[model samples]
Target: MSAVAGKAAERVAQEVPAVQFRPKKIRTVAYASAALLVVVFAVVGWLLGDTPTGVIFRTSDQIAMALLGVVLAGAVLLLARPRVRADAEGVEVRNPVTSYKFAWADVLKVSFPDGAPWARLEFPEDEYVSIMAVQAVDREHAVAAVRALRELHKAATR
Candidate 1:
């Protein structure tokens, strides 16, 4: 490549902002919640183990409860895991059940409205995507994340 072309490539690369957001605080909570669920199930099993019911029934009951605990823990962990990433080209959002990607030009606005559960990215045609990673539960951290994304959006649009 020519020297001028190389310099232009470098400039373009430098202009692309690297921004990432994730539900760190919520993940911690998820871990704790899963642990609590396990403990509660254990306690319940112990308490019910000595019941006068037949051994087969008791065993099946305990097994069912154990399976339920595992399922619930897994669900909690997955639901709380969210991430958002943006570069000069576009943004990606990862929620519990789905992921989406959007070009910077398509993003019209970013908002974290008062009393809302999480932030959102508005696009044209009145459509929007939820940002589960920037949650209200994280409070200040969530706000900072939304602000950083908005700033990046402005710079990219410019």
Candidate 2:
């Protein structure tokens, strides 16, 4: 019984799970977009005041509310909200724009380059996907994620 328990503990210690990655700070594009949203809202407020975008007597309160909706929508897009996960069987990448799950068997290559926000993967059919969710945020975390993913890929190939 003790031998079995000891083996289980060793296996548990050996297995390391993969984690998601994201940008450390807001992306440059996101900042620019946010700024643009604010500017447009400001301009609209100035030009169409107290009329609810054309009427009259809207007051500052209504104008502020109208601008708030625009800001909220902009924030949602610029954030690039997404998640990435990997396991022995496969990897799942998700975001507001796209989501995909791939078995290790389908993956052919993984690479990370300098100046890139994240890693990327190549597969059969000449298809490719960004590993941004895995490598965008930090160097240490990204490397770890890559190494872990490589292991899974190799296993799947076998």
Per-residue accuracy of model 1 over 1-158 as CA lDDT, tens digit each: 58965565445448755788888778998999998887787667666677677654477778777777878888888967699998666689999989999977789989987889999999889889999988998888898889888877776676
Residue 36, candidate 1: C-alpha displacement in angstroms: 1.1
lDDT by residue for model 2 over 25-46, one digit each (tens)? Answer: 4455566677677777666666
Clashes of 1: 0
Q: What is the C-alpha lDDT of each candidate?
A: 0.81, 0.66
Q: What TM-score does candidate 2 reach?
A: 0.59
lDDT for model 2: 0.66
* Colliding residue pairs in candidate 1: none
Per-residue error for 120 in candidate 1, Å, reads: 0.6
Clashes of each: 0, 3
Q: How much does candidate 1 score in TM-score?
A: 0.81
Clashing residue pairs in candidate 2 are 50-58, 51-55, 51-56
